[model samples]
Target: MTERKYAIYDSETSGPRPRYDQIFQLAGILTDDSFAQVDQLNIRARRLPYVLPGPKALEVTNIDPYSLDSPEHYSPYEFAVEVHETFQRWAPAVFLGYNSIDFDEEIVRQMFWSNLLHPYITNTKGSMRADLLIMMRAYSACQPGAFVIPKNDEGKDSFRLEHIAPANGFENMQAHDALGDIYATAFMAKVCQQASPELWEHLLKLCQPRGCDEILSAPTCKLVTHFGVSETHLVTRLASNPTNPKQVCVFDLSVDPTPYLNLSARQIAERMRTDFRILRTVKTNSQPVLFHEGDKLAPEVTAEVTSGESNARLMAINDHPTFKIRVAEALSIRASEFEAAPHLEAKIYDGFPSRDDERLMREFHEAASWPQRKDIVARLQDSRMKQLGVRILMSEAPQVFDPAYRDKVKRGMLENRLMPPAEADLPWETFASARAGLAQVDDPELRARIETWLDEQEAAAQAVLAA
Candidate 1:
């Protein structure tokens, strides 16, 4: 048989914002060099206290509110350390995954970084080797005659790596669980390798794109420049031009030279209210009727149109045909600007994801410690040392020495903000005993000393949470 190839990895994160969220769960199944399963990995990582999971994140995890399981229950960083040190057992000759590019890889890489390990540093040359989503989007043809293939841009049936595996006859158990994620990726990899060998072979050469550059675009980056998400949809790159159905009405006076006759720019803008109609098309909601200064009648003309708002300057018109004509012309010009936007360059294809799934795996390798996250570690260290110093000062318990915040010495919250899964997993009542025990020390110096240790413990716990 051909040399065994590929470790299939999978991950479930707190949300889209990887750096800010936690890697709560992970799964991996190592296959031979040929994408055949050989070994496995599964884990539930601790979360950080500051992680305010978004609605989507919350829905996906459906976290057990009744249970209290914080980083105090386990150590993700220590786990990463162990995993990196023993990479041979689970790592396949080659690695693969479904949507691993953004979700799985990122969760793991960040997990390692948060844990203070460099096992899978992202953005570094030669650090990781995959990004399969791009391959499918660029090379594979979508299911024919499908109207509105879900989550896919034009030229793609569906770019979601998670969906491809199951759609193409790969096994799926529990998604978002670490081990399950791994198995799904492995299974999907096998399916893709067999079904689309040409695409698969080409994808193996891609490299990773670190720091959210390749996975998803934001206001700063653009996607429509590459390919239309659908055949009927127009490509959109402007962040301000996204389609939002919730907007009741939009008045963008920003367009040049009004496009309506006998009406002012303001008046035309008021007419575009969506309380009566809302267009799903990109950028059109921001437009209004063309205002032209036709018969330059009194500049105070007002048109009583749709359902109401404050009786104010929002509906007045100047009746200049040039203004209205200019507005229409302005839209034409703006449309052309959007047309000239830069296309997606090949350089953007930094990672060679192996067709949708592996492409995603390659794109999302969580290889680096989050930028500026070291503060978490620093705070832990500082809290420990400062708590100790303060205890030392109070160690002697001067007869008349009164401090500004001395009350905290006994009754203050004992959380080491650094503990992974910042929120204590145990019920608040369970830790009551531990907290009470920690609070009962009478020796001033001993109390101070204990604070330092507590700080360190909290820090380490927080680190675990972060990992």
Candidate 2:
């Protein structure tokens, strides 16, 4: 069998929201199966034209706003394309990073989706993803002595890459820097693998979609979850969503299963809402830490419930014929509560593009001229693709449009950035909100730079509106 490589990566973004914000710096190191570095990449990009950089994000990253506009940096689209291509070139590898599955991964998907590229490249095409932060949480819970898990000022365990990495002997970790964080993550991975080889191997397997399914298939299992702090739960798989098999609904064994066994689908759904703790939704693809019956568990967790009682509860839940069906119904009901997002970026999960639209997306990227790209966008079958394609043209190739239409697009973009709808809740940072954020910035120099940038943006918006 061929040994798989690890594509460890990190990204520094303009803000927290993946849909609204943008990745400014993306860096990664490709390593052999043994964690020996084979190749590396670091790319920086200017923010998208319509994106308003959050002041607090700028403060934490210590990135100068003006520096993003430097000629050497790639444009947002270019950066996205480069990153996408690089990851594609390093295919069939495990895409690992610190806290990446939650934040950086979303940013990558959004960047690709917004840029007319395939969004699921990392998890598809023989590739999978792993998160060091999640791994660390599991390691600390399951094998506490493997590495030093640092505590925060509040006495809680600090799983922040910067804190945990240094504590585990990654001495030169640069916290907010993308490339530095990748190195620190790689170091931590090596440490975990060295200290507890068996557990490390098991945790790494959990990166794949089917990794946890076998363990979850059993009558009873132990799950280590982190919500501020690590907590172990005796869990039994109730049902996997028919629509999305990755979403497995598990019943907490500590909670009495007898009351739920005979409940109707509607009643189970009601119980799910009233007592939220009864059911825990675990995305198997997201690297959940799970242990089987014979696996050694932490003493604290083992002491919480006797093995005999937990196994009996699991057997009871498993043996009930209609239990899984009702749980599946409840899962579907709970999922239906979230309304469809109106924004194009947030509509990414609406559905997969048609074959014709997918072909056009590739053509749209390959088209030499802006007019050709615009024409291709017009031919797109999906409305979401067409809309996103137009936005791309407006940002990258507005010259292709008629003078009046170009100006209209520019004005609309400016207005969206400066004057969003009063009643609508928007995720993007706006000029008003960015200006408001200025009061929180303590550094006078940074504040002045941000203020000046905001002033320039306002003046520009006003000019476009006047036109």
Candidate 3:
């Protein structure tokens, strides 16, 4: 018989965001840590405002708001009940997901919070949440082919998830739909299991580790409340680090930054077990900078702090942008660019007593501003919709093309087996070119030209018929 295996999970969404504006679909899955299938559950429910389905969503999920009957529509709470009941049967002690913490768990929590009249999150709070993506990330760090970019001759990686499966010897299955996502997560788990059998076995031993139900204590609840339902790599970094300071290695955990610090020199000393001194409190526009009034920064991570005999080290790194691990020894050697300089980068190196700062270090506090990066992952995810829009419009011009460009219009029409677009139909052009023309063209002149052209084309065709 298959080994006693399981994982419980689902995705929640107001929509696929970019792809579909239809009912937000939240899906869940249960599987063995190794991703041997056990059970699957999807919550196709939405409590969303009126927004048209994005071309991408319409293409991928093919959601139709007009088709379903009112009774057929599922509520958020109703979907959760379905998930809860399914879990009750398989009851995998552990919860598993891809990027459920930020995207999935966030939507799940909000759904329960809003829909269920007296909603109490049963699997929430200290629930045994695991991201296969994290396993993939850690595995990627140790193994090969973790990225999915297609770089030019520069020898850089331009890998995305669509290419990930093929790079690692798995097929890229139909994506965006619930089952397809489940299959991909399962595939990733399978890959991780194969790559690290020993670790996989260890994880299986604790499939639903003893602290599986820690939501009893409120911090576990924070896991869902914070709804870090982002991708796997981000979530794992959040895990394995506690929000307190200790004189441990900097590699033990990442430190976060905050508005003000509260740890005193003594408290800081106690945590680091090193002598603490006041750092220069150089204030700044964004965050307050504190230079080391003490000997140096954390010695375990950086070598500069270790050798500095003068306690005049700067307190920085709390708000370092990328959460990278820096060598303190390099700080003393590398002058201006390092933390001690007068510029914004240097001032950020100043120190702060750990507390809220430690908390910030432990979790990702800031979000990407305004427009998010349009990564290949997003583009590939929306591939279906992009194809749909391009195909449809490409099939029939929204307006007729120029009569002089009849061959161009005829080629497209024949290819799609559509009635050939007339000479007056809107002609195809690059999206940018079309937008520019629409922006500046004199509207009345454009209309007159189009009408005149249509009449001439019709008359010409009639003359030919008469001949």
Which one wins on TM-score?
Answer: 2
Output the number of the lDDT-best candidate.
Answer: 2
Backbone clashes in model 2, listed as residue pairs: none
Models 1 onward score TM values of 0.42, 0.95, 0.41
lDDT tens digits, residues 1-467, model 3?
A: 54444464545232442222223555555666556665666657532221222222333354443322244656433554465456555543455567554455444443332221112232434234455554454344334443342443565542333445556556756456665666666666677777667545433332232322221112111111111221111000111112211101121111222211344323332433331111111101101111112212101222122223211111233333322222222222223222443322112223331444233212211214211211211232223222322222222232333444544434443332212233333222211222233333345554344334334433544454354
- Residue 54 lDDT in model 1? 35
lDDT tens per residue, model 2, 17-104:
9887889999999999789999999999986778888888888888898887877999888898999999999988989988888788
In candidate 3, how many Å is residue 156 off? 5.5
Candidate 1's residue-wise lDDT over 227-282, tens digit each?
44311111111112212221121222212222333454344344433311211123
In every candidate, how many clashes are there? 89, 0, 57
TM-score of model 3 (CA atoms): 0.41
lDDT of each: 0.39, 0.85, 0.35
The regions of model 1 sitting more than 4 angstroms off are: 1-4, 50-52, 66-73, 86-93, 119-127, 142-156, 171-173, 208-467
